[model samples]
Target: MARATVQDVAKTAGVSVGTVSRVLNGSAAVSASSKEKVTGAIRQLNYRPLASARDLRRDRTMRILALAKNLDSPIISEAFRGVGDAAALSGYVSLIAPTAGDLEREQQLVDILRNGSVDGLVMFSPTMPDDDIEALATQLSVVQVCEIADSEAAFGVSIDDRQAAFDITRHLIETGSRRLAMIGHRAARSGRLREEGFREATAKAALLPEQTLFADGDFDFHAGRRLTRELLKMDPLPDAVFCGSDTVAAGCVREITGAGFRVPEDIAVAGFDDSIQAEMCVPELTTIRQPAYEMGRLAFEALFERMTEPGASRRGRTFLPHELVVRDSTKGEAKA
Candidate 1:
């Protein structure tokens, strides 16, 4: 079967290629008769909108802006890539705005986005206030991922951090680790959730309530290394260390191995976000799988739907499920 082409559409609509292009682009200045003819031809020929044509449209900018913190993180990079793939299929263009943890810079980006510069917006782990989000939603399609804590706020896609974290903690406990300590981050919801989950799991096992002997630094290797050094210095160092993120765990592993400590023998390490680095380590990190790419795809799909059809509500929020990934990091069981 032969596929349809722009010339075919133009010929069928009884208009020039330029006129058909203008109509496809949704140029506001296009005459009603000409627009109708082009639109009808589009339907008849099963023609698709050209993303580039968005530039020609006046009524709609057809541009989407995505703002995110932690651009350097591999997890963030892949998640946004998933969103971009989904957006491309629908003929949408996205402008990525990375804030890199600068609160003021993030706010500046939001302020700029609110001026009708883009048709849709996605904020990944934004530090913006609820009032600002509500105000922005009044004019544009808005969605959140990973950082949304309030249900009343804009639509979001998240995972059960508490539950997943608990499961992993318990798994380590069941493997016989008794003196457990956690290294967690304080800036993100996932970090908090993972902490709560680990605590709950430890509690369920009726083991000594684990204290955060070491806290993971704010999602960076330097922080992880610093905390690891501090934790190792503690009298009666923990046998098992749970990290809030895989990056932190990687740092912990490096320090532990270099210090002549054996993984899963003397000390076990578990982390969250099963990224590529999970397997790259000498002893792969046993972590939780949050399906970052999947979450990103679903988020953009939801955002696109909202933009094209107003008043269409999604079923009581969607939370993608999580999984426990067991690896050599926590390879052995401890005495109860």
Candidate 2:
């Protein structure tokens, strides 16, 4: 007897071949009743979806690539968790790569992954230029999270970093912090947006140009510690400091307390990306809660949607919500 084909299964199921194809491909558009019938027919006919046959027909690898600047960061870990979970549910596997903000390494990895190894790509806080990102998107489905591309050619999922920064900075100001300082990475677009927010808020509060201090670093603990030491040296040191990341804020907290100053009493502190460090710090950090997990999950979903339906309208940008989390680090009476 000849092996049953998809047509045979469709005939047995009393549905069109397209309907059976959609069901076999895990498309959610198929109704539960139709799916039941198709599955039953497939079982009855003893039909099997051979890997080579499916790949030849669909031209898909059932794999995705996820790129990040650094996997050491808690934010990246959380986001990757979401990506992994979502990919598993969709019968796909995720491959993670760390570019470490090196453009050459990014190019090399992209070249390698673009060679039919992945069906799509998801990037977290990509530091590459918009033109480079746009060029990559033209070749394959790409979704960026956190730091988004400036062009409309690529899809993105992120929170309103500028607005979140503004809100957090305003919160510190309202809490009576006059002299404000900021520590962040100058290399990342997200960091720049955050700095912009801080500057905008301080300017609105009429802070002196001299009083609004600024420091740039790699958005890590060492940078936080080094910059905090510098900020402490200024004449009439800043009464409050905002860091671009929770890890940096934790470093600042350690330095400040080690210098014999009480947090929120001598110099208040605030951080972004309400990561685990925010809660684990000595006084706990007041920070912005970005939806990192959801951003990652949605990035994959958007990419997968484009992969399944190449002609479908693309969701160019998706902005998740952010919240300002008040904690002991930035809550207290104004110090005289």
Candidate 3:
């Protein structure tokens, strides 16, 4: 049997070669009907384009790279799955590389990307400065997911962290939690936004500054355990504790339980990112559900758009909605 070709696709779709090209290149100019016809013909013929050849002709790599602090994070892993799935539909390959939270290493990777190793780059919870990201955007198609930078030149996709935190914290306040404390890392932008939300909710309740306490550290179980232990030692311990992530909350819960305190009876607990750890806790955690998969899909689409249409400006961020899930970890008047 003979192998299929672009010309064959055009012929089978009853479209011109240019129309097939436009569809393959993801051009917005291509009509929906035409795209459907071309895609159908492609499936019918089992046609697979020679990515390398096509890339060479167009000066593209037919690839996109995702950079992250680490691949072990459940949220980042989910987002990477979305990117990979979307890339498959678009005939592009997706690769995820860890930056290990090293700014110099991240810059080195970006420099390699600028040399045309990949068609575009997607950053997950990036640690790089906004100015550096903006500078990179001038040369490469860059999209930030999860923890977005404040750069007008770069495209981003994430849930509203501040608003999600505010909603969750407000839930605690409404449930008779007067003394609130938050445990979060001050390093990441998302953490800071979440902290701001916590503060905002505390202030709205007219709680004294001393009544609202905070402990800044990394987003890890150990940080939660250590900081929570310290918070418990304080006089008039917090009635409610809000952790940055489910992993942290797990540690907090364990520490509280170990100290002979009952959740929501002695102290209520809340967490973010409704991860698997949320459910594994003795008392399931009340947390905010971030749309990580959807964020990843949107991030890839944004990067693809920039790759195909360089002239279009896809500045700023696309925000996804978050859900507040109430569970046994927090003592609320009502469940949601």
Number of the top candidate by TM-score?
3
Candidate 3 per-residue C-alpha lDDT over 1-336 given as tens digits, one digit per residue, 9 for 90 to 100: 966766689999999877887788778999899999999999999997544325543667778889999887779988898888767656678888899999988988887688888888999978788898988887789999999999878899898999998999999999889899999989999999999999888888889999999999888899999999999999998999999999899999999999999998999999999888888988999999988887887787678768877776588988999999999998864354
lDDT for residue 300 in candidate 3, whole number 0-100: 77
Candidates 1 and 3 compared by lDDT, better number: 3
For model 1, the stretches where C-alpha displacement exceeds 4 angstroms are 1-58, 210-216, 332-336
How high is each candidate's TM-score? 0.79, 0.82, 0.83
> Can you write out model 1's per-residue Cα lDDT over 148-231, one digit (the tens) per residue?
645444678878788888888888888888888888887787777777887788777777644335475677667667888888
Candidate 3 — worst ten consecutive residues by lDDT sum? 49-58
**Model 3 error, position 292 (Å):** 0.4
- When sorted by lDDT, best at the front, the candidate numbers are 3, 2, 1
Tens digit of per-residue lDDT, candidate 2, span 1-336: 855656688899999877887787778999999999999998999986533324433667788888888988888788888787666645678899999888888877777657877888888867678998888786678888888878576889888888999999999999898889999887888898998999999999898898798899977999999999998888898899999999999999999999999998899999999999998998989999988888887777678666775665365687899988888999653221
After superposition, candidate 3 runs with Cα above 4 Å error = 1-58, 333-336
